[model samples]
Target: MTTAKDLLIIAIEVDPSGPVGQGDLSLALAGAELIDLLGTRAVTLTGDRVLPAGDAVPEDRLLAEAVASLDREAPYETVDDWLWRRGRDLFAAYTAVLEEDGQLTRERRRRMSFAAPRTTVAESAARRRALHRWAADEPVILALAAAVGIESEQTEEEAVVTNDAVTTVLAAVHDAVMELEAVRRRRSFENAAFANVWRGA
Candidate 1:
């Protein structure tokens, strides 16, 4: 299973309503895709920039699309740029693909007629593989998960990923998530201030 798929499955199975909101999770998933591409040598990291290292397309549709979207020119794309550009609504994209592949199922909302149906990870070999990898505390996956605020039993120091490229991508993901959170907080405060002004408080 691809690391992106495994990471998505683990996220859904663990706690869909937890600290890792869609935005944070999406950024991490984008990082996960890059990590997988690095694994296949489809791309490489030159410092913090992503350099396309191969012309072969990945077998996975999303991954192939990712490879196709690379900036092939000089200076290439920075990992930070790729994360934001590629990660826009990426969680929805991955969920739709998983549902199409029968790795995820959407449960009908019985009472809340206006609410979106709840999606759950289906019982499949894919899920089993993800769980196994999570159980083993694989450094890359663990680090990706931690980026989204999903804490594993493994401590921070113990979850060190050896590959420098992977480590760079993971750090980028964490920074992106933190930046997104900061944006969220700033907007929230602004909205609250606006509401208070309107209320003459």
Candidate 2:
């Protein structure tokens, strides 16, 4: 009995688009194996990989990092004012990605609006919370085989190929999520320290 990880290694070792679609099939199988490993409901393997859900970090820290990052790029002296401006920008970018990917229709996008009262501490906190939730829950990879209408039960070789592709996507998505969380944590720490300095003054 070959393990999912073992199958993944094999799939990764071979090129997907060789003389045949062996590589592609292997990749798909890898994804299926990963889905089994990661717990299906926790993540949905939509396109090339599973969509990640759950809070990656605390709400306050997530917001502070976003504000700090935006302020560093632009110029904002106060957190209250900065939250209002950056919140809109962040919402726009988030919606744009969702729309472009067909995750949300035009009507849906129009109907949905981010309402954060301007210059209020509550508004800033809410905006940060929403952004953190989005960042944490967004799907990292879209599984390819299912998107193309490939069935799981095919041949031994085909199953192997599909598993390989999926595993590759899973590994990449996992790594990316880890990196994002790490960066978010670092930014949160920096923002906390900066906020303390502001308080001291």
What is the C-alpha lDDT profile of model 2 across 1-32, one tens digit per residue?
11222222222222222222332333333333
lDDT of 1: 0.92
Error of 1 at 125 (Å): 0.8
What is the number of backbone collisions in each predicted candidate, taken in the order shown? 0, 32
For candidate 1, the 10 contiguous residues with the lowest summed lDDT are 11-20
Give lDDT: candidate 2, residue 124.
37
Q: What is the C-alpha RMSD of each candidate to the true structure, in Å?
A: 1.4, 21.6
